[model samples]
Target chain A: MDVVVDNLGVFGRGLLVSIQISAATFVLAGLLGVLLTVCRISPVLPLRLAATGYVELVRSLPLLVLLTLFVFGLPEIGLIGPLLWTAVAAMSLYWATFFSETLRAGVRGVPLGQIEAARAIGCTFGQVLTQVVLPQAVRTSIQPLASLLIAVILNSSLAAAVGVTQELTGQTQLLDQRYAQPLVTFGAAAACYVALAFVIGRSAGILDRRLAVQR
Target chain B: MTVTTEAPVQRRPLTVRLGSIGQQDAALFDVPGPQAQRRIAIATALSSLALLALVALAVRQFAINGQLEWDKWQLFTQWPVLRYLAIGLLATLQVTVVSGALALPLGALLALARLSRSPLLNRPAALYIEVLRAIPLLLLIYAFLLGLPTTGLRIPLFWQLIIPIVLTNSAVLAEIFRSAVKALPQGQTEAALAVGMGYWQTMRLVVLPQAIRMAAPALVSQVIRLLKDSTLGYVVSYLELLYSAKVLGEFNHTIIQSYVVVAVVFVIANLTLAAVAGQVERRFVGRAHRT
Candidate 1:
């Protein structure tokens, strides 16, 4: 307990980095996810196949493997960047598959009759997607997307393994090494994660309630 | 108009319920008109070209860095190197199985506790699930790695990895179990109670069997996640596949190739597990339809 109290600044900074990484990954993954979702549902055969393949491949690989690869393997291809950005890039690329899957599920939840009605009304394909499918999909997907955000935050800790030590988990490891108080340090870090998850879950619940279209 | 009959309610197979992607696309859009078809063709060609260009650039980069050299990858052809990785893979499986065996039953108990009528059981169970689910597995592993030693307790590397995997996954599995039990029709419990069965007996004799069957597919999917989580063994200095790859990579001076090989192995292993999950789902669905 004293260890945590004394290392307040370290924990605070760690939490901040975790939040930043989560936020950036959420937004970037969301954008890429939407693009993949569109490509997935597009009429283009090759585009759909490519997007599907990407999702399948990404889903099968673990985040840690991907992180290590990006950290160590990217330099071989001359695509080096700051460690923080590299971690973000890997997370975004990985979570985008999950996001797209959620969106696809949301799109599926939209009643077929509604899409048919839009088409019968002579809406263009693009218009039908923009005006009809997307609005409902986004609403239905709020909870899953929220879960994904929490997932991104939790996974950000893997950044520590790849040498991004400013995140919560990494900071705890550093603190533990210095203080030799593993229980106190790691427990504090765990509490911080729970608090973050709780706050996000609550906000998402409110958003879901507000945005849900009543039948 | 002809007289109409009510349609029977259809139960989706567990595979569909598990939300496999790309299958729902056809419902999202209409069959293309002539203009739409032409546009789709053009888009396909353009996207194909872009994908091709991306692959080409990646290949060129590899070529420039000598990463494409056959020598960098040839070590994988040797029997000794392959045997080393296989042993690491075997160790990874050992942890996954040991942890999974511990988690599933513990998860079932947690689910029961969370669903109990007593707040003593229910509240604490809920808290455990929520807190465990929220914390990252890596942190839990770290807790075991760094924290336990301070209490004057020292465990082996395997337990260090296994304990965290069990702790984290049991919570998730508890949720899966609870949801499956909830999804059972209200009539199941009502019927059991009407027959004078006690709560525990009713849960054991009636609810659990059905719920386990219902949860089987999801449980299999969770195994995939458990397998992935076991890779965190690298952090504990456990001799798991990823850790072994790092060692081998250093010895061979083929870092990229070794990691990529391990990555491929993981992909194949997981995909095969997923296929098994799909099969389990199909069997359950088939049994349900028959009854």
Candidate 2:
């Protein structure tokens, strides 16, 4: 317990890095997700096929393998970047597929009648999409997106494997190695993660309730 | 309470939405007019060219890195190398199977306890499920890996990996089971009780069978997750596919090729599992509609 107290600054900074990675991934992946979702539902055959294939392929592979590939494989192709950015890039690429799926599901949840009603009211394709589809999709996706954010935070720990040791899990491992207090260090780290997850989940719940469309 | 006589609405299988673009696409867009068709055709051509260029760029990089060399991949063609990877795959499957077998039953019990009328059973079950679900599986694995050794418990490498996976997945599986149970019509249980059956008996005979069928696809999806989690066996140096690939990569000096091959193997295995899950879901949906 004293070990954790003595290293409070270390844990706090590590937690901050984890949050930064998760935030970066959420924004980047969310944007890419919207693009993929658009392509997936678009009329262009090749774009649809390409987007679908990417999502399916990425979804099947493990995040750790993907991380190792980016960390080791990308340099051979002359695309080296900072380790932190590499981890973020890999995570965004991976989670974008999931984000697209959730967004697609959210679009699916939009009633067919609403789209028809919008079209009947002389709304163009762009207007119908931007006005009718996106708003409701955003509302329906809040909970799943919250869950994905939590997943991103949890998965950011994988960065440690690829030598990004500034995050909570990696720093905990460092402390454990230095002090041999795995229970104290790891227990504190777990508490931080659980607390973050709880906060995200509860906030999302409140947001969902506030934005829920009354039938 | 009124005993409703309506046929249960056919809920679309989650796999259909997940695995493919469903009929919802038609609702999302209008059928193309001639002008729209021509625009789509041009867009398709442009996208195809873009995709082809991306592929060419990737191939060029591989060629430049000498990663496309026959010498690099030739190691995989040999019998010994194949056997070594096969052994690693066997170990991966062993961990998945053992952990999955333990997790499914334990998860079912947790779900049952959570759904029980007594707070004594349900409260602790809820806590276990929520806490486990929130924490990353890697952390749990680390706990076992680092924490156990400190207490003078020198367990085998296999158990170290398997124990944490079981702990984490059982919680997720419990949630899956609980949702499937809750989705059932309350009438089914009431009917069973009315027919002179006790609560546990109704659950055992009437509720669980259908819940399992309903949950089959989701359960298979969880199996895919379990398979992916087995790759974490690498962290413990457990001779799983990823770890073996790393070892073989180092020995053969073909790190990139080795990881790529193992990744392909994982993708193929997972895709096959996903297809099976879709099939199970279709069968269940068909059965449900017929009844």
Candidate 3:
């Protein structure tokens, strides 16, 4: 308890980093997710094949393996450098694969006739996509998107293994080493995570209310 | 292309003007003209180039690293012997089956609970669900490592890891089911009640089966989620397939290849779920039609 009090500042700072990364990745992955979803549903066979392959490739790969490869393996062949960007790249790639599929499903969720009507009204592919398809997809996807955002928040903990600094889990390991308070330090770390989880849950509630009003 | 050949300056199908030249000149079936064919050829070439990059990356990684010798994919069967291989696979299958079994009825009950008029029950149900939804299964699994053993539960290690997951999954599926149930017209239930049935009997004979059918896709998706989240058992020493794959990755030093293999396996697994969902949907629709 005393150790937790002294290191509360560090833990709090760590919590903020976790939140910031999660928010950034949520935006990055969400936009990329939409693009990838479009690619997945493209009229071109190659795009379809590549999208299926991409989804399969990323989905099957163990996230930890992805993390380690980005952190350690990338610099070996001179593809990239440094840990933070590496972490972001890996996380973005990983989340994009899943998020894109989710968005595709949401896009598919929209009625086909609506898209045809928009096209009939002289809407280009881009216009039909942005105006008719995406708005409907976004509205339908708010709940699941919120769920994925929470996933991004939790997955940020995986960043700890590669030393993205003492986020909640990283701080727990460090505090544990310093004072051997595995139970207390980890518990406190867990509390910080729970609090972060609450913010996400609350924001989802806000989204629900806003969406309800809009509807 | 309602081909009404009145005199037009540039008599092209509107779709052809959308740059779908290939479709326009394929004689509606066979050999396209040269220009349209060239456009298609270019598109195909660009496609090959794109795919070539990924294939080259995988080949180059294996070549540059010279780590192909490290992967022992055969160990899954050859080394594990007959007993542990079944143990390994069954260890994975049993947890998924049991948690799914637990999740279905429990999720239904939570769905029912949330719909109750009592604020006392509904509020806590909502809170429990929201918290569980927000916290990733990893942290919950971590907490469960410390949390479950104290119960002195005589169950095996699989169930030890399963409880927290079941709890989390039940929250999610319950919400999906509840919303599905709510989506049905209020008239259905009222129509049943008008014929003089109590809530439970009507729910049993009229409401629930319909709700379950309506929510089938979301429910099956959650089941697939259970399969993925079940992979989290590694954190708590449950030694699911991902953990096994990780062991191979670290031992062999060919991390990408290992991940590639495991990912292929996941695709097969989820595709199997998708197939099952499709089959069940067809069966249910058939049944509904017969009724």
Candidate 4:
């Protein structure tokens, strides 16, 4: 018990790193996802095709492969950085593809008649989008977006595979080595993950209820 | 500051483009105007150039690093290398198959318990699903790796990966099955009961089959996930594809090449699975429409 207490600091640091990576991944992937969705739905045929290609290509490969490529392949081009950042970049790219698909589904879910009505009411294309389409799309998208975030958080555990030691999984692994108490150390890590997942899940549920559309 | 200067409303050309795109038929959108065609042509040309430049840069970097050695790839043509990769592929498939076979019934059982009337079964099933879903597959894998041997069971290392995967995947599969079951029209279950079938009989014959059919596409995709996930076997030195890639990379001093090869193999395999799932889903949808 004392040993476990003593190891809290290490676990805490790893947890912090995991949070930092996940937060950055969430923000970056969100922006990229929106961009990709826009590209997907844009008038530019090439852009749409490119976005589709990118998503499919990324989707077909495993995240571990992407991480390995970034870890081993980045330095070749003089793009050296912290292991965590590299992993984050790879992960964000991997997730942005899925996020784009999710957002695209949301965008498609919006009723076409609403957009036509907004346009008939003298709304510019931009106004129709910002005022009418995007709001509803975003509202419809919250559940999926939350699930995507949960996936990012869960997948961030793979960062440890690439030697990013400042995450919950990494820290737990380190402690497991030192204390030789796999059940206790990993069990503690599992508790932390479950707690984080619950927080995310509960918040998503609250937002879903609060933002429920009155159809 | 006395007179109000009109700052231009920054035109969101992109959003406008998206709106226009959405309004038009995706294929026929190109047939309308020369202006649209030219715009598309210019965009394509520019994007192509950007892609080419990115590829060129990567090529140059690899060239400088002397990682473009033809000999490094030749090893792939040899029997030993093929055998090694085959072994890794076999390990991955074996784990995915065994775990998947186990997960289906376990998941169905979990789903049944969750949907059961009794709180005793319901609460624990729900609890198990939520807790297991919250846990990362990696952590579960690690726990099994470290904890299982302590039981003094001389279980093979392969079981370590398989057991954890089955446990985690069953929770996920349970949810999929639950959703499928819930999505069924209430009439089916009630009709089965009306025919005087027992509850379990109704579930086994009427509910479960239809639900499993509805969930087949999702189940196949989940199997693809299991395939990719079996790569985590690298952590415990289970000699899956990724681990084999690492071994080959270390042996040949061609880390990036080995990873690229492994990635290609995974991509092809997963893409094939996805294609199969797509076909199955279409067939199911088509059958429903016909019926």
Candidate 5:
């Protein structure tokens, strides 16, 4: 208890890094997700095949393996340098796969007639996509996207494997090492994580309500 | 609620939009047109260009390194720890399979409970879903792994992490399924009840079949999640595949190769499960369509 209280700032910094990683990954992956979802149903056989293959690849592997690869492998080949990039890239890759699926579901929900109506109004392909397709897709998908972001937040703990110092999970270990009481340190960390989760979940509910009212 | 004798109105067919189906498809590589030979020539040129680029990169890497390092892949096949990795991977599979099996029944129970007419059961089910939906899985993992042991419950290391995972996962899946079950027309249950069927009998013989069919895709996805969540066992110090990869990286200084192999293994395991899920979904959908 004394150790956790003493090292509160250190632990708070780790929690912030986790939030930063998850926030960035959520935004980037959401966009990438829509793109891949479009690709999955692409009229082009090769494109559809490639998109399917990519999603399959992402879903199968453990996040720990992927993160380990980023930290240990990319630097060896001169692809990455700083340790945070490793965590960010791996987190983005993992979340993007999930976000893509959710985005695809959103895309699938958009009525076929709405899209046709937009094109008949002489909208360009890009305009129709940006104005008509994506707008509604995003609306229908907020709930699922919220869920995926929560997952991104959770999986950020895996980044500890790649030497991203001071994550919620990692700091627990740190406190355990210094304080020699895994019980108190880990329990405190667990409570913090759950509290964060409760907030995210409630925020998502408020978003869901706002969207419903707008509709 | 009035039955209509009038035939449905038929609308004219509308143009197919690009997002729905691009005039060519998303990225459009198919050229099965009359100018087939010309298209083939373009495709062939593109392939050769890509091949050349890959070879050039390999050549540069080989010249710089004096070898492709391709021979180093043998670490996967011929290591003293290879057996341990296999054991760890099997443990990973066992955990995933067992957790999923446990989750399915519990998920169904909670889903059914949510649908119960009694407010006591339904409201608590709602609360459970709300709480589990909000929290991250890692928090649950920490709770089961670290918190439970402190309580002197004394669970095995393997089951320690697995319990929280199953609990949380089943809760979400319960929501997925309950939503699907509730989405159906109320007339199905009404019809059964009007025919003097008990609530349990109606649920057992009627509601479940339809709900399961509708929830096929989600069920498949939850299974994939279980497979991935099995890796979180590493955080709890359980010897899953990812933990084994970490061990190899820490020991051999060959972290890249070891982790890549684990990634490939993960991809393979996921793809295999996905394939099975696909087959099951198709079978169920096909039967639904027929009936």
Candidate 6:
């Protein structure tokens, strides 16, 4: 307990950084995912194939590899950036592929009649997508999207590998190295992650319930 | 009131305009007009050129760094580098296989406990699953790797990686098995009981076998996840594939090249497993449909 109190500054900073990364990655990846989903599921053959190719190629490799490339390989091509942005980019690129798939699933969950009704009512493709399709798609996709965000939080731990020292796992490493109290420090760090996961699950559940009630 | 209100809505057929059954066009839009076609063609050409430029840049960088040299890659075929990577691969395989083997039985027990009538068993099982699922695998590994030695356990390094993987994965597998069991029609369990088989007997002979079969694809995916998770071993100074690649990179001063090779190996291994799992899934689903 004393150890935890003394190290609060370090661990708290780490947790804050982890949360920031998760939030940033969540928003960026979600937008990219929606774009990719539209491309993958669009009528344009080339766009669909291109989106498919990108998702498959990126998803096949581990996040670690992508992080390595972003950290080491990006600078070689003059796309130099800070470690934080590069980590976020790598994560967003990896996660967007998954988000697109989940969104696709949600789109599939929408009833065919809903789309047909929208179209018959003289909605254009874009109108139907934005007004009729996307709302229902997002609602249905909430659970999976919640899971994906949780995954983002977990994967952000990998950002520590590339010298993102402000994050939870990174702080754990720092503290562990200085104090050699892996059990106490890492335990506290794990507790932070577990607590965050619980919060995510509860919020997602609450949202799911609210939506259910509305329906 | 809410339950009654939801009943009718639940009965609606959920078939949306999913992509066409065969050769799914993931693209959701309709046929393009002539103008739209030209725009698409332009977009495609531009995107292709952009992709080509990126590849070209990477190639040029590799050339500049002297990583493209034939002699550099000879490291892969040589005695020491090849042996190191091979040993790392073997280490990863060992942990994946051993941990997976142990987790299965433990997971099965956990599933059974959760499904059992006793509140005591169900309560702990639920907590275990939720808690383990919440914590990241890396954190779990870190705690055990760094924490346990202080407690005077002093176990061998082999058990260190194995213990965390097994604990976390077993919890996941438990949930999978529980869901699989729940998915088995309730009538099946009742029918087995109607024949006077004991609870354990029914689970072992009737429910479990069917549930395991139902969950095999998901189980295989979990195994693939474990294979990926094993790479976290590098953090603990375990000579796994990623760590081995880092070592070779440092030795050869070709970190990017070394990492690329490692990534290729991981991709091939994981992709093969996924392909095999897909085949098994298709065959099983096909049989289920036919019967």
- B-chain TM-score, every candidate? 0.89, 0.87, 0.77, 0.85, 0.77, 0.83
Instruction: Tell me each candidate's i-RMS in Å.
Output: 3.3, 2.8, 7.4, 4.5, 6.0, 3.9
**Considering every candidate listed, which one attains the maximal lDDT?**
2
TM-score of each: 0.94, 0.93, 0.78, 0.90, 0.79, 0.88
Docking quality (DockQ) for each candidate: 0.55, 0.53, 0.28, 0.35, 0.41, 0.37
Which digits, one per residue and each the tens of the lDDT, describe model 3 over residues B249-277?
A: 67755455555555556667777777888
The candidate that achieves the highest TM-score relative to the unseen native structure: 1
Model 6, A78-124: lDDT tens per residue? 56788899999999998999988898889888788778788788888
lDDT of 2 at A179: 91
Work out how many backbone clashes candidate 3 has.
1
Q: Relative to the true structure, how large is the alpha-carbon lDDT of every model? A: 0.89, 0.90, 0.70, 0.83, 0.75, 0.82
The TM-score measured for candidate 5 stands at 0.79
- Model 1 interface DockQ: 0.55
Q: Tens digits of per-residue lDDT for model 2 on B140-183?
A: 77778888888999999999999999998999999999999999
What residue pairs are clashing in model 5?
A43-B25, A43-B26
lDDT of 5 by residue, B1-291 (tens): 999999889754553332243233332122256686566557556655765687698567534643337555667677677887898889898999899899988998888888899999989987787667655676566556655655577878878877888888889889889988888789999999999999999998888889888888988788787888888877777889888887876677666677777888888888888888899888889989999
The 10-residue segment of model 4 chain B with minimum total lDDT is: B23-32
Against the hidden true structure, what lDDT does model 6 obtain?
A: 0.82
Q: At residue B13, what lDDT does model 6 achieve?
A: 42
Give per-residue CA lDDT, model 5, range A17-116, as digits (tens): 8788888877877777777776676444344545666787876777776777777776655565768766787778777788877877777677777777
Candidate 1: which stretches are off by over 4 Å?
A: B1-23
